[model samples]
Target: MSYVLCLHRWVGRQALYERYGLEPGMQIRAICTAESAQSLPEDRLASISTLESLDDATAVIAEAQRLIELHGVPHRVVALNEGDLLNAAAIRERWGVPGDPCAWIERFRDKLTMLEVAARQAAIAILPAVSAEDPQAVQRLLAEHGYPLVLKPRCGTASRGVRILRQAQDLRLLQAPHAEPMMVQAFCAAPILHVDGWWDGERIVVLTASRYVNSCADFGPDSALGSIELDADEHERAIAEQVAALLAVFAGQREIVFHLELFDDGQTLRFLEIGARVGGAEIPFLWREVRDIDLVGIAWELQTEACSRQRDHARTRSRDGRPLHGERGAWVIGRRESPLRTELGTLYWAQEALPAGVPSGVYEGARTRLRLRSFDRPALVRDVERIFEHLAQTWSASA
Candidate 1:
């Protein structure tokens, strides 16, 4: 039998075990944080090991060694959490497992490195970015990119510690300083669109583009934000091609799940950043519910190489054999103060809520979240505008 070791600090454990548990000739062993141990399925308890913290690579390696002693060496080691990707890469390197190396993964984790790779290798346009610690470098970036800059943690997640320097006064926040490394980028006033899908070593197997109704900078604790799936139009197709090229430059030969964010500046698309794992927020849910595909499950399959299924499984067609990528599908996330009540009414609360995975709770400290989906393009657009209008009204009222 082949042994597979799965590591997860906060997310994707249940789904990982549920999918890998029943596969023939595979014995799945999961190592997760102590707090998440209880949440692991009771039936799958025997194969799970709880640790104080997965952030410690030593503890994880020790656990992996124990698993190796009991069973044979694991053929594959996996982690679903974005933060754990590096730790997982370290373990894979130690175990001589088949996966992307640490250096390759770092290109995606580090903001500065990602920009360099995108600009140099992929020939993609990126905003001027620099380390926030150096005073001279900061000034250079300001001089080149001008004001209205964006500052974020070099390795931040979920929009935490992200700030917008709209005016000269905002630069004061940078003066006080912090120990953690940060990056400053030129702020673009373009609508943000995210592309989520799988990238085989050679091609983009499946891809979907979503336009964010509200920019991340505008999102707040109670902000109403959503993304609508777009038809695979010419613009979307070009974006996908660009993303595939960038991934080819980053991963080389590794197959991985990719969530890429870009700025659609009317005339052209500019690079934002990319995540090697599945997209956060309602992206995975949208893939499963709206498109009838288990994106996370497919990612797991790619990691373990346990399944021989082709990417064709995720391809879609209408009753008349027309490609369905042009069809309408969307997901909207709203808070209690959102227009879902005033506009969507009962239809808003009718939809089911997805489990808050890993970095639980909403990004930007949202208190409550309501998610809804629709296949009607016009209806999706109308409802999205209503949500955005409600957000604008709420912001103005607070101001």
Candidate 2:
């Protein structure tokens, strides 16, 4: 029997099974971390295994081999987190799967490679960058880019391991020993912008543009980070076009869900970095609650489409089983979303990224998270500000 095997890393049934697990005559197995397994609905899965951590590619592959022996090769191997991409790629290779996420995943993960590819293919203006491979890499980059340079891991998320050099004295942070490979970028003084949407293999059909209230790199126990979806503006169309152009370079006008970040200095939009998966934080919730779009589900569906051609069956009920947010007949759509649901919004005070023994929140280490929506744009903005005012500012600095 063919079963879909998920390297499930998310906690709670809400992530994978809440919307799709009830389907009759469908088989889905999952390998999850012990923490995630606690909340995952065991009654639905064909069988489930546990892992201490998903990063151990070798251990996960051994589990895959054993699972294969029991259930045959999965129709597709699913991994939704960025850290899980390479592990999933390895599993796909071992199973002789058709998809090769590894081919372009580097462009998505490695910041240096990601910038080079974007510049070469889309004619996008990318910030000058150098790899932090050599011990003298920072010294060289400082000489070239000058002060106020930014250094971050080539493959990182949640703004972890990011460092900014405001003065010459900051060089110590770079010269000090480190394990994670880093990249140096000439810092741009501008508002950080992000464009998120789903691609239908032709053009960008569904997208929302937002400018960060505070930079993603600013997240900390003391800082509050969030993004507000931009209202209709003259530059919106132009920005979407640029994002579409860059995505076309990597995807070749093919199906993909993307989270793209760029720097806009009121004139030119500079490419920062992009991810093949959905945007983290409250983006998925914002898309669903505010836009009547299931962005995370769209991302999940793209993977199934990636590994197979079957179109009808899906984990979540995609609208009409057609281009989800594409222009097709009035966007009759979910039409205005219903009254705000309590379960729809959450505030994550802590996460695994924090030190052990502290309390844990929903999933990621979002000190404060909420998804608000209103047909009136002005009211939505007010609601966001209202919640922000009441949230506690101090969080544990276990990060």
Candidate 3:
């Protein structure tokens, strides 16, 4: 029997994958960390192979090959995590499966490549950047831009391994990063905004943007992260327009879910980076609970349809795959942790008012988070702040 193979991470993803992927006559299997796999419903996964981490792509692909040899070929390969995208693409390429190609994935994964591609199609303002490995390029960037520039992984997610060199001595913090490629870019002192949506191969069918309360770069060993969705009164249209232009440039053969970040001053927006996966942390949760949108399920369904099309030439042999069920909203909210404090990705408390039925103990992404929605955007923002005040007090006392 044919099955869907998913390279998954994070907790609380069991329901999303099961609902869309495990229909009658099909199976859903996964390669996930043991901690993450515990959340998976025992009955939903046909078989699961636990590993030290999904980041080890070689072991992951080997385990998948073993699974397929023992069970059957996967009709669809699914990968929702940012790190898993290329590995999933690699699997598809190996099996002659219908999915994104690895080279195409690299264009999005590699910071320099992404910037070059986006530049060809649009006049997006971007910070001057260079590969960290190139000594002369690094020297040129330092000489030109001087202090307080940014150095980040060429292909990083969730703001991991990023450095802001405010002074010369700070360069010592970057000891080489265990062989990961890095990029140095001029830093912009502006608020960072994120855009999330479904990008059909042709156009943006659905979109939403959020402004970070504290920039992801501000996140340190002791930090809190949060975001509030932009109201219609905000630059929702302008942000969407900019995102549409870039998405048009990066369109692939299959539909993709995107998470885009950029520097947004009141008058202009500068390109940061984009990921072709559902946004992490409280993003998918807020989208579902507040907007009645199932971003995760939509991602799963998009890949499934593509797989079917490839298997049967999609019946009509055309139509790249239908668009996502578009969802739009002016009010929603998410917090990655308490404003009081954090202990470097350590597990923290979820207060008594934690959203009903949402898992409570030991979730990885957030200390506490809530989903708020209203047609009254102003009222919704106030209510969000009020809750933040209360949660801050509760968490501060605990801290």
Candidate 4:
């Protein structure tokens, strides 16, 4: 029997277990923090070993060793959470298991290392970035890139601790003590587009290109964040090529899931940082709903190289078991912000009042999915604006 050790903080459990549980002779054991343990489904709870906290590496390692004693050395150690990526890799190396080692995973976790590697690749342009601690280096970047710089953690997720510095006074944020290293970069004005897919050791499988309605940097409790899957076009094709080239630069690392974000100004594509796991938020669901692609399932397959051909075949099949071109899908998050509350509440009410097929509900929670089709790009953009207008009106009326 093959054993897989799954480490997580708060995400990817359902998808990971559902895929791995299907494999014959595969035993899945999980080590998760107390908070995540409460959220586990009944079936998942059966095989899980809880930890007081995920912060202590020593505690995590001890729990992993206990699982190994009970189930034998894990054939593979998997961590879908970005924060736990290094820990998972460390465990794999300690056990001499067949998976990415700490050094290999660090290239993806550390922003500086990731950009340094990408900078050497052809056809890739990276924004000038430097450690915030080096005042002279930051001033050099400020002089070169000009005002309106970005400050963020060297290794952060979900746009946490991200700040925009528009002037000299904002530079004070850099002087503040940070728990982890932080970086400063030239702020790009172009819209952010994320390419969600996988690399099969050679080629990038183009799943979908999503255009963010609002900057991730702007995402907050009061922000209404969303994305729409872009139609297959020249722009998407170009984005896919760039993603392929970026992955090729890191050719040493193969068979992994990548969530690559880039800045596209009609004429140029600038490389933004990427995450080595599945894209956060509603991306995985968007892919599944619109393209019938199971990103998490594919991620597991990539690690084990199990059922690659089968998954490839399945990708071509639609939800109804027929070939599909694509479908327009939108995933929106309603935050505590008045605009989102009003817009999303109105939309939810409308969906409930209307018939089943009109904006069918896919998933609901902190993030919600609605099925509505816009015939063309202009129409889609207009529709999104209309929702914002409704939000504004609702906010005004309430005020």
Candidate 5:
């Protein structure tokens, strides 16, 4: 039996295990906080390990090794949750096991360093960003570059603690004592389009792209409504290729899996950021549907495969894997166009969690309310329009 060491005990672990056929009998180890560990599924509880100090790579890899030795070396050691990219690199280093290099993951995870490297490479146009810890330095840059800039945490995810600084006066609120260096970049009025794919070395095996309807909505801990549009063009592909090539340079000797977000400022493609792991929601599912490739599975093979011949397993198998029976679409609902002050209305659908109906102010996950209308893009569009109007009316009445 094979085993994979996932970093966090979140929804991602469950989904990966199920998708890769590693759920039952196979050992699935999860590293999480004590509180989260307690709530882990009973069947996989034995393999669940709790930790307090997973803030770095060394401690995490040590714990993983202990588990691996006790359970015997599993086929591949991978992480789906926190400290994963760190653990992956550490596992390869400490145990001589296969995993992504720490540097690759670090460059992807660390915004400042990523920008520096990208700039050095002259790979893609980027917004001028500086870590928030250097307030004076960022202020200096702002002075030189002007305002209407963006400030974001160096190591934050999903747009947490991100804010737009329109002028020098706006800097007052950003002076939190505990704030680390925030990445400050010149805000570009670019249409945000995300380019995602599975990479082995520099090779792009499975690729897909999408444009975001609302980037600001998903910028924080709130549910945001978004839908996916397929069929991109060569213009999008050219920019994605540049990102991929640059990432390949950054990874050097190590192999890695990556998801890069870029922007089209009408005339040019600009650098956004790259996620070391699989991207959230639509991108991952989109690849599987359109390319017939299981990015999760390919990542597993990349970590476990030893020889060039075995590389075929790492390739996408869309021609043979499950076929898409219908056109699929997903929508994330949240406080948008209206305030969350009243009963926006209920999400009606046979398969929704809130089948009883949703009241307003129920802001949830990245995908709060998704209507997966298969083979019905037109109907889905109409339904989404109606819902948005209903929400606006609901908020209007209360206001």
Candidate 6:
């Protein structure tokens, strides 16, 4: 019997059972932090085994090893935890499963190292960016890059600490050694787009490429979203090629499912950064919705490549699934000043009834998904405005 033990379940992976056909029998265990374990549904409640600390490599891996001994080493072990990628990579290697190279994963996560490696690759077009602790180095970047540069953590997801510095004061305040290491970039004037997919040791299986609409200077915080069509224009094609080439260099001798970001001017597309694992909640969920393919499932199959041919066939069948007409999008509702709640209300609205005739009302709470028909733009604006008015601003920090 084949088993897949997931290291964490918060990244929409609980849907794995329904979406990927993993029944209780196929899943040996779900290992996650105790707090995260609480978030699982009752049905998922059965197979979970909580770990005290996912941050401690020795303890987490040892717990995982113990689980493997009791439940038997799974056919695959994967991590959704950003901090646990290295651990997952090592565990996959020890268990003799196909996984991304630890060294390459490191390069992918470390923004400084990623830029350095991509600079050597002829195909990639990563902007010249720098991460520094020195005050003078920070000042030099401000002068060289000029105003309206981006400041973000070297290793971050979802545009968490990302910001645009428009002044010398902003640079000085952000440059200090406060918490996470920060990367400063010459803010390129371009529309941001996300391209997500897997690398089968050779080629990048381009999944879904979509445009991102940011509410503020950075892509993070409260932002509305829209889906753009997939077109491999010369600039976009070059961007993908550049990303593929950089993945090969960073990966060296392993396979990976990379979630990459790009900056596209109408004329050219530039590489932003790459995440070594699956992207956040919406992309993976929405991509499968659009393509009828499961990236996580492919990742698992990639781990057991003896059936590479079969897996490849499955991928072709899944990837060939027709794209949906119109578009689907995800949006986050938060204010620049407010204590944003985490729960996304309820999923009671129908997709066909949005953006046009929907009533405007504030559903107070966390972020909620409201589906809209292509022709429902007016209704969407009205409803969103109603919701916006009821929301009062409060000082708080959130993603």
Best by TM-score: 4
Model with the higher TM-score, candidate 2 or 4: 4
TM-score-wise, the better of 1 and 5 is 1
Q: TM-scores for all candidates?
A: 0.82, 0.80, 0.82, 0.83, 0.73, 0.69
Candidate 3 on 336-397: residue-level lDDT in tens?
Answer: 34443432111122333444434422223444544545455555556555655655576566
Please provide the root mean square deviation of candidate 5 (C-alpha atoms, Å).
6.0
Q: What tens digits encode model 4's per-residue C-alpha lDDT throughout 147-256?
A: 89999998876777889999899999998888789999989999888877766668765556778888777764445566776877777777677678888877545776
Local distance difference test, candidate 1: 0.69
* Candidate 2: worst-modelled 10 consecutive residues by lDDT: 328-337
lDDT of 2 by residue, 133-252 (tens): 664766777787789988788887767789987997886776677767888789998899888877677777667777776677775555556666666556777787777788877778
The parts of candidate 2 lying over 4 Å away from their true place are 12-26, 38-43, 121-123, 135-140, 306-363, 389-399
What is the C-alpha lDDT profile of model 1 across 38-73, one tens digit per residue? Answer: 455555434888887776678888888898888777
Which structure among the candidates has the greatest lDDT? 1
Q: Which stretches of candidate 6 lie over 4 Å from their true place?
A: 1-5, 11-27, 33-47, 51-62, 65-76, 81-83, 90-98, 174-177, 215-227, 230-243, 251-254, 304-314, 318-366, 371-399
Query: Which clashing pairs does model 3 show?
Result: none
Please provide, for model 6 over 1-399, each residue's C-alpha lDDT reduced to its tens digit, 9 standing for 90 to 100. 566666763522323643344434554467776655654454633377776666667877887788778767776666754566788888887877665657757787878887887777776467767765655766687777678878878876555677778876786656455567887777787787777777666766654565655422342235433333344345545566666677777665566666777777765667787776666545555555544556655655555342354346436643322233334333334323232243223222322223332222121111433332222434434444443443322222222
* Predicted structure 1, TM vs. truth: 0.82
C-alpha RMSD by candidate, in order: 4.2, 7.0, 6.5, 5.7, 6.0, 7.5
lDDT, candidates in the order shown: 0.69, 0.64, 0.68, 0.68, 0.57, 0.57
For candidate 2, the lDDT comes to 0.64
lDDT of prediction 4: 0.68
Where is model 5 poorest over a 10-residue stretch in terms of lDDT? Answer: 355-364
